[model samples]
Target: MAMAMAKLWMYCLLVCLGMALNNVASAQGVNPFEPDGGRRREMVPAMFIFGDSLIDNGNNNDLPSFAKANYFPYGIDFNGGPTGRFSNGYTMVDEIAELLGLPLIPAYSEASGDQVLHGVNYASAAAGILDITGRNFVGRIPFDQQIQNFQTTLDQLADNLGAIEAAEALGKCIFFVGMGSNDYLNNYLMPNFPTRNQYDGQQYADLLVQKYNQQLRTLYNLGARKFVLAGLGRMGCIPSILAQSTAGSCSEEVNQLVLPFNANVKTMMNSLNANLPGARFIYVDIAHLFEDIVANARTYGFSVVNRGCCGIGRNRGQITCLPFQTPCENRDEYVFWDAFHPTEKVNIIMARKAFNGDPSIVYPINIQQLANL
Candidate 1:
């Protein structure tokens, strides 16, 4: 009887040790932005993306909006056809899908034709964190309306995956939100909007942060736990802004606006994380990363960084970089794909920086580190 009791005690001890080890492994493996590294965890089986043209694959093509990219040259390099992405080929979203071992997520507009699977993109070009950004543009989907579309997409997913499964999917899935560039470029800086006089740079930035927090909280309430929040890129250095300055240099005026804006966003993320439980918000600093690549092109194996390859003139603004426009023979030399967007090679570099946990490029914490959280 004594020996049997001793064996039972030993077995219990072994079970306890096993449980502790498993817990450590699980904690170490948890990735908020992506699935666990090895032997993919089936937890987040989908990714629901929302934002602006940076992520908008083809949503605006169907929508009655002036901010449309569902035509030639937009997707010219993507499968030799227009996929509505404002790039020569795949976007950051497409790369994320590839990394997650998932199929390309269809646009929310095209969700009708698909098998109702993993994910859909609801990003619209010229959309902003604030509803007014779209309204100011006159005929674009507002951020609030975009969220409504997200709700519709979720409803359909729930119908297919069942309510509980849909909720689980959303809770575990990665939510990629990339926006705010248009808010600065189109709405606030356009000089016609009352917002320009109503709010100074700091005040405007604060307003945007508030809007972001409210929208994020809404998504959180809707069962979103994992979020990949991409901050605004360097607006001052874009080809268009350079052309506006006419100095053949980046616009300090625009940079001044963006600097405080990014700072406020960082502060907001911190406050949100503190307030919300189990909230994994990873801020991808696209500005700093792009700046580094542009400033030190040789370090990253690029030949040119100041001007775009596709467009003409010193500022890449002789004309809009359409299909008929003459493209530089070597695309790898330029940092920008067009007057406004980065080249595919640049996006790939940014994605690598995001995945590798570059502290400077990814503020607070990297996406991979956030996943561990």
Candidate 2:
């Protein structure tokens, strides 16, 4: 009994020493590993992704949303075929997961207690920052609903691993928010509502930014410390917008309208950093990266930057690729796979850049660095 007591005392002493070291490291502005949360083989213990079709994966499969892509050709290049990813293969988050040494995280609806310990994806196709953004697509999960689901996931996390352990793990994880495109495509531009009349372009963007800031704060309250907020790309450069232009050039008018949203988002990230203690926010500049790709298509090994690899109208942006539609023979040569999404190859490129690109693309820090933090 004496020997056992001695051993217990030694262990306690070692644990206390470790805690002191960690506290010192943290005080010096460095992230030190926690005893329970830092044992993972991956850079990040887990990644909780929240967004729209850009990183949907398969969450919208059962959401009754017409904005689903759980069909053939959508995932023709991905494993298990049509896993509901909007891209031909892996989505942006999928590539990031692979780089982080994790398997594809299960969708929120498909994940259970233990399965969610690794992570859960709350992204849904057609979902946006605004609740009514994707309402046209019947049954879409809005941003608010996604956050509620995340709360549910948090409850499950606490249940599975105990509250302390679960919270620790989440602190070491990544929270990626890639929504807002649909707020423009499916809401502002949609003529059904009086949104256009209610607020001009810049006013509408400011409104979205205000709501986005609140949503992000809600996530922080839910234990998300590291945030990856994707800024909007050039909406007018997509095939759908190009089809609307008689000259087949980008609609500069639409482009200017969308610029303020991205600017506001960057400002929000800065504000979040200043106001939220211990929070790290990284902004992704998709517009600049996209413009570079289109401007230097040949240099980037892309043969077509103005048209979709699979579609029916001018530049193939008039309508989304239909079921069984024949895709281009050289998919890698096209910047876009469909009217609305990038090809698998482009997804890989973007993921690689975001993982380790310069400040021009991923400002403040790259995803790899974000994961480490």
In model 1, what are the clashing residue pairs, if there are any?
A: 31-371, 32-371
lDDT digits (tens) for residues 56-81 of candidate 2? 88888887778888887788788798
Q: What stretches of model 1 exceed 4 Å from their correct place?
A: 1-43, 113-116, 134-137, 312-314, 369-373
Which regions in candidate 2 have their CA more than 4 angstroms from the true location? 1-39
Per-residue lDDT over 153-184 for candidate 1, one digit per residue giving the tens place of the 0 to 100 score = 77866676578866765776778888788888
Could you tell me every candidate's TM-score relative to the true structure? 0.84, 0.88
Best by TM-score: 2
lDDT of each: 0.75, 0.85
Worst 10 residues of 2 by lDDT: 30-39
